[model samples]
Target: MTVVKFLRLPENVDLPLPSYATPGAAGMDLRACLPDGDVILDPGCIALVPTGFAVEIPSGTEMQIRPRSGLAVRHGLMIPNSPGTVDEDYRGSVKVALLNAGKEPFTIGHGDRIAQAVIAPILKPQIVEVDTLSETERGSGGFGSTGVKE
Candidate 1:
């Protein structure tokens, strides 16, 4: 298992790491953040909640951002940019952009665990230049190249 250390900048920023886990993984807490007064997530209104902390990741590592499943199923809420990426070189506070897809408005209050971030190692691919390239069976196939029915 990878060792990820979390730093809580503020006195109240105690983001539970186990709240965010891999797919098909079960945890102790069903949910952390409690609902506040009703608030709508209209277009252009990025619902970002601050973690109130900054992370220090060693070089060649990155963090993957994901949404809470329970909220998505019950309230039609999700992260606008699913699987948000945070670079190792970044030095800013982490936040989540939540979007409400439901017809009614949703509320989020202070100390509410709106989102979770996971740390992972990053691999950089080498750039190659060549005059000739190889071909494949489905060569040059763009969007909708595969069978639409299938």
Candidate 2:
């Protein structure tokens, strides 16, 4: 298993570290580190919620920050950039950008599970310039080219 090192900010020392909710969970739950009052997110508004922790991910891997399904379904909360990438070299505080899509305003309290992070290997493929390219059956089909009932 790949290990990730985390540094808790002084102000958020009382907060719990990120943890997997279940044995088969693929990502670890990240909590909101708000020291002040709750964040009130108006409909169609976006907020950068801090996690107050910096992570040291192993080389060749990245941490993907994703929205929690429950929050998305129940509160219409979403991560604008779903699966936000945290490069291995990043050592700054982790923050999740949340967008409220619901009609009603939503409140985010401190220690609320705002997002999840998954550590996965990254592939860096070499780029090459070629005059000719191969063609396939689905080449340049674009959106909706494949039938919906496939």
TM-score of every candidate: 0.71, 0.96
RMSD of each: 4.1, 1.0
For TM-score, the strongest prediction is 2
User: Residue 17 error for model 1, in Å?
Assistant: 5.3
Q: Which portions of model 1 show Cα errors greater than 4 Å?
A: 11-40
TM-score of 1: 0.71
Q: Itemize residue pairs with steric clashes in candidate 1.
A: none
- lDDT (10s digit) by residue, model 2, range 1-150: 768999998769678889999999999999999998799999999999999899999999999999999999999999999989999999999999999998999999999999999999999999999998899999989889997895
For all candidates, the clash counts are 0, 0
How would you encode candidate 1's per-residue C-alpha lDDT over 1-150 as one tens digit per residue?
A: 555454655533444543434565432121232233333566335576656555666778887777777777887778789877778877776666788886667777655556656667788999899998799998989798987896
lDDT of 1 at 139: 90
